[model samples]
Target chain A: MTMRSLTGTGMTEDGMDELLAQFLVEAPELAQQLAEALLALERMPGPGQALDAAFRHAHTLKGSVQLFDLPPLAGLLHAAEDLLGALRAGDRAPDAAALDALMAAAGAVEGWIMGLARDGAGIGLPAEAAALGARHEAALRALLDGPAVPAAAEPAAALAWLPALLAEAADPLAEARSGSQPVTALHYRPAADCFFLGDDPFGLLRRLPGLIALRVTPRAAWDLESFDPFACNLDFAALSTAAPEALRQHMRFVADQVEWAGVAAAEPPASPTVAATRDPGQRLLRVEAARIDGMMDMVAELVVAKTGLAGLAREAGGPATPLGRSLAARGAEIDRLVAGLHRAVLGLRLVPLAQAFRRLPRLARELSAQLGKPVALQIEGEEVEADKSVVDALAEPLLHLLRNALDHGVEPPEARRAAGKSEAGRITLSARRQGDQIQVTLEDDGAGLDTAKLRRVAGERGLLPPAELDALDEAAAMALIFRAGFSTAAAVTGISGRGVGMDAVRAAIEALGGRVSVASRPGQGTSFRLTLPRATVITRVVLLRLGEARFGVPIEAVAETLRLPEAAITRLAEGEAFVLRGRALPLLRLSDLLGLPAAPAGTERRILVTAGPAPCGIAVDGFAERLDVMLRPMGGLLAGLPGALGTALLGDGVVLVVLDLDELAGGAAAPLPEAALS
Target chain B: MSIALEDGRLRLAGDCGVEEAETFLSMLQQHPGLAVDLAEVAALHTALLQVLLAFRPPLAAAPGEPGLARLLLPLLGR
Candidate 1:
């Protein structure tokens, strides 16, 4: 009989690729933790939990780093691990310089992690950077100044696994005796926290050429209630025809977990299979977004197919007929199942906002160091969940907001004392889920936006005329920061004012069908709030008709829909205007926006009012049912069409183009917003 | 549901991941006499396998993957 592939999961199973992918995802998190924890430990005195955690992160990082071919990275981590071990052992007192060196090492590793993500081996990182790792190693080693103190993990006692494995694969073992290769036996009990360290038990064995027999068993009984899907719980025992050195070399990463019972000839045996042993695990599986998106596409197709099944069934026979009834029942079952499947597939794409928040603390540390402005960043509700795409897209805008806070909104430590505020400025990044939306706000305690300066900047930059700038209220003036080419900073720093303005940040958030608004009270500092959908695939859109052509716009973009009398709308040379809530709101005819003939006039005009960077209203003929649709971004020749969000396939077999309200609300060439309040 | 008990026959299809293990166990415990059908199971996670090992429900059909079936059938004493 053919031996099992030994590669767990067997689907495109390049064990190295999977392990590297896992490492790339997990290591940066470790690096961030290592930096943050050490930085915290330095500020706090005595041996506390953070010290232990710092050591654990460093030790865990080293374990994963040593397995790869990058000697410099591995060496630097090795030295850091030893220093941490010494600190944990109370062999030496923790000092700021040592902590600083360790933090620098963490920073280097964090940088290398990005390069590692691009390529499993070395990416095109500069040679000096790799050499810098060695230098960090030398610096850390000098700080360490002793024989490495190895914090060996206690060996897992797995006596029953081998005998069970031998019993299960006894026949394969006897059959393999005829083979010439020197067989070796090993009981690989991976560290319980291996998954956290990116260790795949069977993945480590993928390199072993010959696997005559194998068996997987749990290290302990499964506790039904406490089963952690992220923790590594399985013990793998295998008999391979490969030499002991080769087996040991491949298992080097997890050398502690393995008990080498050499010479398989002396033993009674185990071809292999996958997924023999595992803990329900503590960590979530990192799936490529493309995989889930592909599944979503299939599920969408299923949705379309299932919608027509009843019609086809009714055509075959009347609903009263047994055949028709059976078909209808089957169709109903498919509907429920498809709906459940859709939810499940969407759930796979739901990642905690922590994914976006993890990197920001490191950024705060770096920026705080760079500016010499002591700022305390407090993040709350990071456990809030959002779609992977949405969470991934959030980092850019969030980073910019944070940088803007530290650089501009937050006052320097001495300056804060002069303002009677605490010496250390506080910036809070809070997130919360509100119905179908996730609102993330970054608030900083610094000299708040100077509306006077904002208006002056607006006037000088030609973003708006001085008359219009003066007409804006305090809140309206604060919103000018998001206007194209608006920056109040007198001098450009390496951070927020690096050519890209707040307008880019606004665009990024709006492109995701989200809203970004700023609020400030001069000396109290600024708060930027971003309201984004919890998921991207199934966006809620209001379907409306303009001159017989139906269109859809994301509901989040439409602040409110109203009916206005023709007398309310006064025609201007630029376009049209209507007064609402004591403010002049620019109104655009939807037909005119889409270049279609105007809708026949009615006593009352149906208007879709949007709250965006430039608030405006679009007049439409009629409104239809709001739907949650899978929005496919414009492709082929239709790409980059302004005001078009994407297309959605309706149940009636029509493709509805969802409008990008923000883009439509603020296009220079578009008829919209020329008469806008400016 | 990837793991379903229909008419006392528990069926697992496609890829049975660890996420389903908790429900699979509860269902196994709830219906003690439910036989299993892994005929369409493309891949089985270790958590589900351990649960199967603990329960040892009678098999309605051998696993679809030959390699998996070979190792699992005997362990289940089928």
Candidate 2:
């Protein structure tokens, strides 16, 4: 038991930090490039330069995985390299199955890299990861030892199976074809004694992706009187949105028993990552994102230091003297230099939204199959750049919106045609740089929100009273869907309609200093536009004193501050309220909110009004200077405390607790439950 | 017995194994309108589930388990 504690030894060992950090930075880029190389190889008639490059990248990745002492990941990577080596040696052609194995192996390594980034050397790879690694390794090894990737099936054999599956799964396959993109049809028959061998064939069939249709039939006519329950006598066939290559990869181990038919040529992958890999800057140096952030913090320090020197020159000899004038000139020079350096470092933090768009293509494919409404996603301005933190945080909200577009907005094929619209739906995602802000637009050409329906659902769910529903205008009524617990899904799906609805998406965008709005034209489409800061540069925070401690509140959240006479504040039964502009506004004492002792009776203090939902006045003892500083998110022992955004450092090296006005005003005074972190 | 008759419904709770399939089949045959409830089951063996699939008995309650529902829902014509 004590030996498990010794695992910390890996982190503290000299030089491991730099080594692990470098590994984290280089591995993901390398894996990305390798995936591109594999894609090229898959599309080629015969491998050439791409195969050699892929082999080299796989070799490099395996070495990097081994450096972190992750043997299982290394082993999986090694098998993939071995298969690539065989292809290079002309021992085997690069078949779809082998390429599938290699691509999946690369994806698996990417996941491992993420875990390592989160926990560093303290992470022991999960048992599930090890099992997945073993399976990938086994499949690759078998490919190396077995015959070449199976040949394309005969046309006559396909005819025998295709009609049966369609007939069996008629309803499921009806809306499956929205356009000419392509569909993969498969027939899989397990061994006769598979059940005795502990293989539930139906279980594997159930896991198929985009499984629009599936049918099970007895291989030989079932003789009920003589039937044996334990004997596996069934044949399974399915139709899916998965591509032919993906289907081959999924059924790799059972390839001999499976037959793939009716597969159209696959469309070129529309992933931004694939385009990013072909980038001309392949030789660009890789640097860790954290190191670039640290540089930004240092730039802030230099600016502060330069400002302090100006005050010193005044005390020494007023600005007219030679010493004072020379000091002033030097300070001006330093200021110019610092501004240039700031821009250069901030440039390092600007990453294209491309990386965030990688999973989008796969998402659209799966959704198309599930809803039986084909959606074509047109992405524009992926080259638009934003702060790396902003790029990363926007992924989930964007995914939720995309899911919502497909799940509820898009109509089934027949319905769209009946409405005099195109059979296939189109979703356009566009990004642009608007001065200091980035505007992202998601527009789907589908059935737009029905304002009347929205109002009815809101009233039916008791989220609003009949009077309020009747009084609201169309825009406000449409916005009701953003309220938590509001859902229009006829039945809950595991995707967009899961309990976490549009409200979570709005909260996330707002937390990043962004605003989201929705507009729709009934029968035309629905569009969502989100405007976010290009970067949250140098947070301007107003410092206030609470019980001998100073806390910072983001200046954007503070509406105004005033020194009020004792006669102004009125006591109410609930707590306190102040009359402002002929209206009553709630007032909460900072000390009371933080659960600290009350101020002495008749002590004079200033009031800070917050400019958001539940507009309120917060009374605190006093206020200090408003300054721009780098805010670091809460970590270690201070982590998970309610209403805490992060911390900023003051000149005296004191930590100024930054408050999230939204969390505080919303009244979540307790720490978040542990389960919410995941 | 993992398959217990409760009120008019057969409650398939906990783990129902292969040995229980015959008794389940007998119960289905005897009660023409028999429905199975899976709200409390933890791990249901394939043989017992196969019986339910073959008979297409009305489900009083679907399994609280997601994997069970995900695997068997489409097959039950839902």
Q: How does each model score on TM-score?
A: 0.60, 0.58
Q: Please give, for residues A393-502, the per-residue lDDT of candidate 2 as tens digits.
A: 88988999999998888888999999999999988877777897889989999999999999988888998789879988988888888876798776889788778788
Q: Show model 2 residue runs off by greater than 4 Å.
A: A1-24, A33-283, A303-337, A370-372, A451-472, A484-491, A497-499, A556-559, A572-588, A592-597, A603-605, A609-616, A632-646, A660-678, B1-78
Supply the DockQ value of model 2.
0.08
Go through the candidates in order and give each one's C-alpha lDDT.
0.74, 0.73
Deviation in Å, model 2, residue A575 alpha carbon: 5.1
**For each predicted model, how many residue pairs clash, with residues at least 3 apart or on different chains?**
12, 0
Question: Candidate 1 residues B1-78, lDDT tens each?
Answer: 688876668899997776787788787777887889999887776666767766677889998888667656755666
Task: List, residue by residue over A363-451, the lDDT tens digit for candidate 1.
Answer: 88789989999888876556578888788889988988999999998998888999999988889887778888999999998999898
| Model 2 lDDT tens row, B1-78 | 688999999998886655666777778878967888988776665555555656678989988888667556666766
Candidate 1 chain A, run of 10 with poorest lDDT:
A268-277
